[model samples]
Target chain A: MNLLLLHPDQRLDGDRWRLDDRQATHVRSVLKLAEGDHCRAGLLDEGTGQAVIESIKNNEIEISFKVDSKPVFALPLNLLLALPRPKMLKRLLVDAASLGIKNIVLVNAAKVDKSYWQTPNLKGDLLREKLLLGLEQAGDPVMPRLRLAPRFRPFVEDELDQWAGPGRRLVAHPGPFPELPRGLDEPATLAIGPEGGWTPFEVALLEQQGFGCHRFGSRILRVETALPALVGALMRLP
Target chain B: MNLLLLHPDQRLDGDRWRLDDRQATHVRSVLKLAEGDHCRAGLLDEGTGQAVIESIKNNEIEISFKVDSKPVFALPLNLLLALPRPKMLKRLLVDAASLGIKNIVLVNAAKVDKSYWQTPNLKGDLLREKLLLGLEQAGDPVMPRLRLAPRFRPFVEDELDQWAGPGRRLVAHPGPFPELPRGLDEPATLAIGPEGGWTPFEVALLEQQGFGCHRFGSRILRVETALPALVGALMRLP
Candidate 1:
């Protein structure tokens, strides 16, 4: 964990904060911090600063913070992704969140397996847990907003206009089309399809919505590999 | 499976070839091919074309081929990587091979665990299996060349000049240095460090060998996530 992320409610009396088992174990074992030692810490969606270990008790670590109140590293792009298998879903969610992508809409596609939507990972706590792990790895305080779109057609036709950040729209498909131009000037909304890729009808549907079709290359990458690659290629890295 | 990959030795008669269990199962269940059906197929490092299914026996499938000779999509970059944990090693080998990276040298660093050098994944057959899976996913016929550098100093001092592809040399370090300048003009050699990153001594040793330090961004991405991201950011995709 790059950052010792503390939730707002974890605040005890005054500047003191209490950490749960997860963060406590990380601090104790990974960071190998002792009483009176300070580790890089942050508040959820608040700011990044330092935390001094005050005490280590049963299942919790008490820390006193010195923080500056502001969010760190919110990515400009919003993602529209086809739900992958359960295992892949876990990895992508964590990776995408770590990349600081501001928003994600996991939508259904013709190539997506019907049972993928039934996974427990779609539930609240499990989903939030993955995002939190990502946030901690990034040392970022802001949580990327996540939404689910189980039905493909209605989501694109009805909700997509409302969903997309105001910018260019693109779809990652099997292509000899133009490359995703580097360093997009505005926030872009990119739609990535599932394993078999979008059907012709699905691609046409997205095209009707102004989602320009493109490919990174002819080599079809796994969704887990493609997201970061596409993200890095689409934006200018700081 | 994107391509039905065949070994040249599998050819049994004038136009007939036999498939092992892996390919036979993929053809029978995944591709659902029957007699007289053709699938996209290729011979190892030889060429890509099509194969016609002749019959399915107990453990093998017989086929006839018409292949065109040439390797597809060898990436114009050589990678100097720090070996990750076993599970991650599996994914990266597959992904890197699939991306068409032509050469990889897995090197050691202070932060790399000694046990990582001892993984069964370091052995020959399992390592080749991962690369073949990646090649099949990409529908590419060429296998990437891989080398191991268990000793850091000797490899960079004695072998690096001969190992490096002639052009710009880079090391992916935590940086405010500069973005990996987009699309290099010639073949390039890029080195990536271990999880906690290269120690200053390691970086300095590399710098002496003309490896310029660079970063993708401020975000600390996983080795798996970072490889594809770095690869995508460094090269212009087709």
Candidate 2:
């Protein structure tokens, strides 16, 4: 973990906090920090600062923290992704969160397996856990908002247009579509497909909502790999 | 696997091949291919074609193939990376192959743990297995060449100049470096550091070798996340 992320509830009094869970284990075992050493710390949804180790006993570590600065601003992007397989979903959650994407909609798609929705990884707490890991990795404190839309049609037809307000709406589909645009100064909503990609009808539906189809060249990348690539490309736009 | 990769020894006749390993399992169980079913197939370092399932018996599957097209051209990019932890190394091998990067040099740095070189994942067969998985995912047949440099100084001082030929020689370092350049039609060499980043001495050595430093903005990403992002940005330059 790059940063020790503490929840609001973990506060003791004033600038003091305690951790006895995975963070504690990381501080004790991985970091091997001594009592007087300081480690980077952030409060969930709050801000980041330095935490000085005060004492350690019985597998719990107490630290005194001083809030230095608020979390980095969220990226001006939202992701509309076809729910990937369970294994890929875990990594994407972490990847997307680490990239500073604040809003994500995991919508169902034609090729998405129904069984994927039943995976324990999609459970609320489990998903949050993955997102937290991502936050720690990026040394950010803000948590991204994740919305699940198990049905494809209703979400796209009824809610997508209004939600993706006033921005470049692009869907990543493999075909002779236009290359991804550059210099996107405004917010952007990027829709990425499932493993087999979006069916034609799904592409049409998104297109009707102003989602221009774009190709990331010929090589089809796994969702885990594609998320960072696409996000990086968008972030690099002048 | 998106494509059934066939090795030379798997050939049973001019146009026929047999498989009894994991590929066979994937065909029988994951794909559930029947005798008459056809699936995409690629010959190792050769070409891609279609495979018709001829028969399935005694835990073995036989197929008829026809060479159709050569593998996709390799990306005009080379990667110089500080060896990541073992788990990330496996994914990166797959990722670099999938992205069509043909050459990779994994070098040691100050922050890289000495034990990382001892990882079983770096074993030849295991590394090849990961690359194969990547090629299959990308529907490409050619494999990437991996070079290991256990000692950093010699690799940078002696061999790097010849290896990283003309065009952009950029090292991704966090700090006051220029933004990554864009719109280049020439071959580029990208060097990425390890978890804690490159030390000043290492950066200076690379600079003396004519490597320019660039930053991928402020957010700190894991090597797996950063590789795709940087590669994507470079690919989108034009």
Candidate 3:
């Protein structure tokens, strides 16, 4: 953990902040911070703040905090990804959140097996578990909104317009195309397909809705691999 | 495996090629290739070629090939990374290869434990295994050359200059200014520190040698997260 993240609710009386087992153990063992040593911490789902080490005993580490700063607003990129397998999904969720993605929409694709949708990772508690890890990695408090839309067609046809941040909408496809827009001047919503990639019809449906189709390169990238490359390309734009 | 990769030496007489157990099982089971069926195959450490299923009944499936095109080269960037733990090292090796990185210099960092350098993943045979997997993922034949330089200073001061491609050099460090060159048009050799990031002294050495210090924003990213991001950014430059 780069930074110790705390939530507003974790604050007890006055300056004292309560930490859970995982955070406590990390502070105690991994970081090995002694009392009076200063470490950075942020309010979970709130703001970035500094935390002073007050005491360490048992599995709990009590921290004292000062005023909270305004939380960082993420880049207005809405990543629509076909959820990868469980392990990769966990890392992607955390990485996306840490990278300041404002929102993520996990959808089912033709290449996605039905079983992946049923994994325990989709559960609210489980999803939050991963997102929190992401938040901690980012040193941000506010969690990016997460949505699971199992039905691909309705979500894209109906809900997409409402969710897109305004500007370009691109889908990552491998065959051939003009280069994807780099350093997009405005906010964008990028759609990444599953590991096996979207079926031809799925790509066609997205394209019909004004989503430009572009390939990163001739090389095919995994869903997670495509995320940073596409997001970085957009970051370079404008 | 999207494509079966074979070394140039692996090519045999007429329509027959020797098959390893791993490749044999993958062909017979996963791909389910039967007699007379066609599948994509390429020459390892060389070029891409086509393979036809000549027979499939025995313990090994014999295949025939038509020598066609050479494999694509990697992006201009050469990855110089601080050795991570075994699992992440495996992923990094594979991903770098799949993305067609020609050379990877795994060096020590202050934050990287000595044990990580001793990981079996760093061993020759194991490293080859990961690179082959990466080659298969890209449908490319050439495996990236892995170089080990235990000490950071000598490697950076001596060998790095020789191995540096004809382009810019940048180190991914979190700090003010020294933003990554926008629209990098040159072939660059980039270095990334371990998860904890490079030390101030290390960053200074790189800067003294005209290596630009670049930051991918404020959030600290996993080593894996940063690789493709850097690749995408470098690809967009100039």
Candidate 4:
């Protein structure tokens, strides 16, 4: 808990702010912070700054800080991923935010079970909780933007055009399609499939949109394992 | 466990094998193997084959295998990594084996603590334990070959030259080095640094010997996170 993230409702006046029950408990209990001890705080979508503890009691705490500096860092690129299981999704949210991903689009893959979307972790508050963990780990005060699209075809065809970055688009597939171009310093929109992977029709649709089918290796990797790998590779290019 | 990996001592006859106290417990308790149950078994240096449970009783169990095929899906590249923390190292060992890496060259890194080498996981038996877990996950019978070189300089300049393959060589560094080449479809040798990463001196030495420095992104990554990312990126390349 490097940064104590506060929801918008927590703000009080000018430099003063109030923390919710959860964060107040964490600061008072886990951090053992006392009056005069400074702690970091951020408002969702607003900005970040240091907050000096004004008082702490029960499940409430008061803080003061200069709220000018931005509180977080979102990744330069947007990630559109197929929703994985709850446990894995929790880790993904944290890791993605820690890496400063700006936007995440969790779309439905054909193999995605309906039960996965109903996981408690997907709840707005819980999702924010996991993202905050990542933000704190990365020492960023900002939160990554997240969007859920339960339907795949509509999201890809209707919304994908607006999401593609300035450079080439690549889709990671099992078998080889083309070699990842070298010295690719420009921003790119890369797509990774689900555990069972994208079907032939899905791959064909993506290909028609100029998304090249590419593979990382012959070995199969779980989604949690694949996301960072793809990001690292893309980031490595020029 | 997908594949049960055994040591040389476990092999009794052409097809018969004996389970030690620990393995016997895993077979009986975890897997709940009974007479005539089918399993996969692989020798440390030999091939993988199907095993049949002959009997299960007391503290020991008897099993037999049909010797036919060799377990042969080792990664296309060799991984030269600095020793990470004991816990992460344990995971790395299992992941390396499961990912089908044949040789793991553990060297002392400038940032690596001297105490890490003394971890029980580095011990022969302990290391084998993790590799067995990896083999099981991969459904492969063969275990990976593990090697340790106390010094980084001597090993790379001397022993490593012999195993260097004919392709791009990369070192994970967080510097101004050009983005790593994308779409690597050929054989290569990749080197990873310790927690704090390689020193300037080490980087210069490595670069002098044909290794190019590659940075994943601006944010620093833990060693455990870096491995799969680098491996995935390289493998994704054509």
Candidate 5:
């Protein structure tokens, strides 16, 4: 873990915090820090700073934290993803979090296997756990909001405008099309397809919603690879 | 498989090819093609077109091949990567080829585990197999060149200059450095450090070798995530 992610509930007092369970084990074994040594740390949805080891006890470690008051900035991007397979889903969740995307909506697509919706990996807590790994990986404190849309048509036709807010609406498809437009700090929602990609009708549906389809290149990229690539293509973080 | 990859030696006669083993099984089971069916197929490092199934038998399938003469284009990017863990390596190899990267040099680094060099996945034929999967995934014909450097100092000090010929020489790090400039279709080499990133000494040495380190925001992305993100940040495919 790049940063010691402390939960809001873990605070012992105003400045002191207690760490236990997986984070405790990681600090004890992997970090191998000693008393008085400071490690980079931040609270969930809080700014990063340093935490000094106060004591190493039997079951837990006590530490004192001093963090910057600045809030972690969320990227003005919303990822509208076709639910990938379980293995790829795990990787994407971690990446989406690490990349600081503000919102992710996993919508059903034509090629998305029905079995993917039934996988345990899609469970609420399981999904949260994956996103946590991502946040810790990037040392970011903000948790991204993830929503599921099991029905593709209704979600796009009904809830997309409000969810996407106001910004660039894009669908990333194989290019020979126009280049990705320059990014604005305002919100952008990028829709990526499933394994075989979106059908013509599906593309038209999203197009009708003001989602301009853009191309990265002619070669098809795997969904996991395409997510970060397309994200990088659209914007750069400050 | 998006494209059924065929080997040149699989040709039974002038225009007919016989497919057996894993691919034949895939065409039978996953693709579920019967006699007279056609599938998108390509020869390794050759053009992609169509192959019509002429016959299906007990152990093998017979098909007639017809392919375009156009060569698959390689992205003018060389990836200088620290050897990642085996699992991550497997994913990177596939992605590198799918992204159409021309050259990848896996160099030893202070943070790279020594055991990574000894992995069976790094074996030449095994590496070839992974790249093939990537090629098949993208329906691309060209295979990326993979080289191993077991020593860090010599590889950077001795080989970096010649290896990274006539293009932008860069190292990716956590940044608020500057925005990545627009891309050109010329050769560029990007060096990415290991999981914890390069030590200060190593970064200095690379800096001395004419490598301008750039940043992709403050988020420390995983190597697998960073590779594509940086590659995307550098250049977009034509």
Candidate 6:
């Protein structure tokens, strides 16, 4: 963990906080930090700062922190992704969060397996746990918002228009579609489909809603790989 | 498996081949191909074509193939990566291969764990297995070339200069380094450090060998995420 993340409630008195959970274990073991040593720390959804070890006990450690930096800014792009398999979902969540994506909509797709939504990884606590790990990795304090849309059509026709707002809407599809536009000046909502890609009807539905199909060459990358590639490419726009 | 990858020795006669290994199982179960059914197929380091199922039995399947298309071209980029942990290495290999990175140099760094070099995943057969999976995913026939440099100093002093050639040489580091140059018209080599990043000495050594430091902002991405992100961003040049 690059940042030691502490929840709001973990504060003790004015800048001083005590951690006894995994963070404490990590501080004591992995970091092997002793009194007077400093480590990067952040309060969840608050800000980042430095934390100096004050005291170390058997199971907990006390530290004093200073909040000096604002939370990492969120990206201008929102993501619309087909719900991946359970294992992939975990990694995608962490990656998406680490990449500074603040809003994510995991919707159903034609090729998405129905069983994926049933995985325990979708539970709120479990999801937050993974996102926290991502936040810690990126040294960010704010958590990305996640919304689940098990139905593809209704969500697209009803919610996506408003959620996407005034932005370039692009769907990642493999075909002879045009390359991603350069210098994307406006915000964007990028839709990534399932492993086999969106069906014709799905693509048409999205296109009707102003989603332009963008192809990243012919290589079919896994969703985890594609997410970063597409995000990175889009972020590089001018 | 997106493409059915066949070994050169798997060919039986003119335009015909038989398989009873994992590929056969994948064809029979995962792809569920029946007699007269066609699937995408490619010969290792050769070309891509279509394979039509001729017969299917419990353990083996026979097929007729045609070589029609050349392998997907390799990217005009080489990668120098500080070796990642074992589990990450597996995914990195697949991601690197799928992204069309043909030449990769996995070098040791001060932050790299020595045990990473001892992973069974580094075994030739296992590494090729992962790379094949990546090639199949991309429907590309060419296998990426991988070189392992367990010793850091010697490799940099004696080999990296020649391997990197006369292209844009860049090291991905965090700090005041300038953003990656745009419109990269020539071939380039990108060096990415391990999780903790390259030590000052290591970066200086690489700098001495003509690698310019480039920073991709402040986000600390895992090697798996960073690889695709950096590759994607670099590929977007021009």
Considering every candidate listed, which one attains the maximal lDDT?
Answer: 2
Candidate 2 C-alpha lDDT tens digits along B145-196: 8989999999999999999898789998887879877534579999999999
TM-score, candidate 5, is 0.94
Over 4 Å off, model 2: A183-185, B183-185
Q: Per-model C-alpha lDDT, please?
A: 0.85, 0.88, 0.78, 0.74, 0.84, 0.87
Query: Measured by TM-score, how close is model 6 to the native structure?
Result: 0.96
True contacts kept of each: 0.59, 0.55, 0.41, 0.36, 0.64, 0.58
Judging by lDDT, tell me the better candidate of 3 and 4. Answer: 3
Across A112-195, the per-residue lDDT of candidate 1 in tens digits comes to: 999998888789789888888888888887788999999999999888977895888989877678777776646889899999
Could you give me the TM-score of model 4 versus the true structure? Answer: 0.68
How many residue pairs collide in each prediction?
Answer: 0, 1, 14, 15, 2, 0
lDDT tens digits, residue span B1-238, model 3: 8888876565678656766678889998888878888888887766767788887667676788865887665667777898888888888887787777888899888988999887776779998898888879878787788888889899888777778857888887777755666445457888889888888888877776668887767776777877776677667521
Query: What is the DockQ (computed on Cα atoms) for candidate 6?
Result: 0.56
Interface Cα RMSD for candidate 2? 3.0
Give one digit per residue, the lDDT tens place, for model 5 in B177-231: 5556445478888888898788888888888888887877777788888777777
Chain A only: TM-score of every candidate?
Answer: 0.96, 0.96, 0.93, 0.86, 0.94, 0.95
lDDT of 1: 0.85
Q: Residue pairs in steric clash, candidate 1?
A: none
- Model 6 segments beyond 4 Å from truth? A182-186, B182-185, B236-238
| lDDT (C-alpha) at residue A91 in model 5 | 95
Ranking by DockQ: 1, 5, 2, 6, 3, 4
Candidate 2 lDDT tens digits, A171-220: 98887888877535579999999988899999999999999988777886
Superposed Cα deviation of residue B32, candidate 4 (Å):
13
lDDT of 1 by residue, B41-158 (tens): 8888788888899988775789998677577567788999988888999999998888888799999999999999988889988988999999899888888899889999999898
Output the better candidate (2/6) by DockQ: 2
- Badly placed stretches (over 4 Å) of model 3 are A236-238, B182-185, B236-238
TM-score comparison, 1 vs 3, better candidate = 1
lDDT of 4 by residue, B174-233 (tens): 778776555465677788998668898888777777889976665545565667667766
lDDT, model 1, position A8: 85
Residue B209 local lDDT, model 3? 68
The positional error of residue B175 in candidate 5, measured at the CA in angstroms, is: 4.8
